[model samples]
Every structure is written in structure tokens, then in C-alpha cells.
Target: MDTLVLRLQPGDDLRAALDAVLKTDGIGGAAFVVSGIGSLRGAGIRFAGAETATRIEGDLEILTLAGTLSPDGSHLHLSVSDAAGRVSGGHAAPGCVVRTTAEILVAVLPEWRFSREPDPQTGYAELVPRRRSSQTL
Candidate 1:
């Protein structure tokens, strides 16, 4: 396993930057361990059964960011705190802009690949591992 650390600058889109790195590096499978002190004017979070994210406006501190990401797609969760110390968390979506910086470490699995496929039972696109095919000499 190899690791790649990314420092996202101010005014950068958090989600987009992460995605760009994974795509650019051809990282098919990875686990993102992310952290940093930053601010966001607004954040979009997806709650249960919601088709899209719910936008919240304010300058907030990123408290918790955890999730799995792949070239095909990503499943991330985020929590932010406002000036009043009120906190909100949910599925992290696009439009999460960075105020200061965002540091992310991606642990890459070079031997494997991942893709998202729709599950009939769950009705959601789920992560599916695609291992490298091998052949005996």
C-alpha cells in the first residue's frame, strides 16, 4: 500500500479536488483519511432519502470528515460547526468550498480496482471490488 497526501488551498472545492487527484493518479481504489482546519461559506449535505444535498449557509469549521473514495465514485460524510457551536453532519456532497486548507491522505490499493454498481435490493450505487485478473504462466 502507498499513501498520497494532498493539501487543498483556499477557494478550492473540497470534493472536486479529491476527485481530481484520484482520477489523475489513476487511483481506482483508495481510503481517504482527511483532516484540516478550514471554513466554508456553505455546505451541501444529503440526509436520508433525499435525492440531493441540502445547502446550509454560514462560515463553519470542518469538524469531522470520514469516508471511502474511488475513481468511479465516493461515499463521504462530513460534519461542521458554526460560530454558535451548533453542529451539523451528513453525506458530503459537491460545492463544499474550502476557506483555509484541507489536508487529505489517500491510502492507495494498487493491486485492486473499484467500481460502483446499482444494487437492486438497496436501489443505490454500491462499491464493488474489481481485483486484478491473474493467469498462470
Candidate 2:
């Protein structure tokens, strides 16, 4: 297991930075263990049990970020606040922009793999794991 520390500066796209890390590192599978305190210019998030997403265009502060990564796609959950500290969060999707800066700590998990596939019962994309041998020949 390894951890990649990221420091995003002003005018940088927050989500884009993380995605870039994954693409650059070729991290097909991993999980975010810790995120940092930072500010964003604009953000878009959707709550659970909802279809349409809402956009918040203002000074946004990332309070917390939790999620997993996989080859299929990265499953991310996030929460943020405005200048007043009013909080709103949900499944990490597209259109989440950054304002000032954001510092993040994304953990990389090796050997173990994560993926999202269709779930017949729930009709939602769920996380699934792949098994690998611990022993060497």
C-alpha cells in the first residue's frame, strides 16, 4: 500500500487533479483514506436517492472526501461547506470545480483490485473485489 499526497493550488480543478493522479500513476485500484481542508471556487454534488444533480457556485470548502477507485471508474463520496460552514455532500460526480486550493491524501492499494458492476437487485453500480494469491511460486 502507498499514499500519494496532493496539494492543489488556486484556480486548479479539484476533481481533475485527483483523476489526473490516478491516470498518471496508472492506479487502477485504490481508496481515499484521508482528504484535507481546502477551498473551492465552484462545486456540483448530488445527494443519495436523487436523480438530478445540483450545482453550488461559490467559495466551497472540502470538509471530507471518502471513496474508492477502480478500473471501471472511481467511486467517490464527498462533503463540502460554504463560507458559512453549511454542509452538503453526496456521491462524487462530475462538474465539481475548485476555487482556491485543496490538499488531498489519496491512498493507493496494490495487489487488491476494485471494480463496479451492475447489481441486478439494486440496479446500481456496486463495488466488487478481485482475489489474488499471497504466495509466490
Q: Give the lDDT of residue 108 in candidate 2.
A: 80
lDDT per residue for candidate 1 within 1-137, as digits (tens), equals 77777778888987877767667645556555555446777888897678889998878888887776777778888889988999988888999998777777667776767678899999999888767655410
**Model 1 vs truth, CA RMSD:** 2.6
Candidate 2 residue-wise lDDT, 1-137, digit = tens: 77888778887766666656656655546455476667877777878998867888888888888777666676677889988889999976777776666778888876676778999998889989875446510
TM-score of 2: 0.85
TM-score of each: 0.86, 0.85
The C-alpha RMSD in Å for every predicted model, in order, reads 2.6, 2.4
The alpha-carbon deviation from the true structure for residue 108 of candidate 2, after best TM-score superposition, in angstroms, is 0.9
Give the least accurate 10-residue stretch of model 1, judged by summed lDDT.
28-37
Residue 48, candidate 1: Cα error in Å is: 2.7
lDDT of 1: 0.76
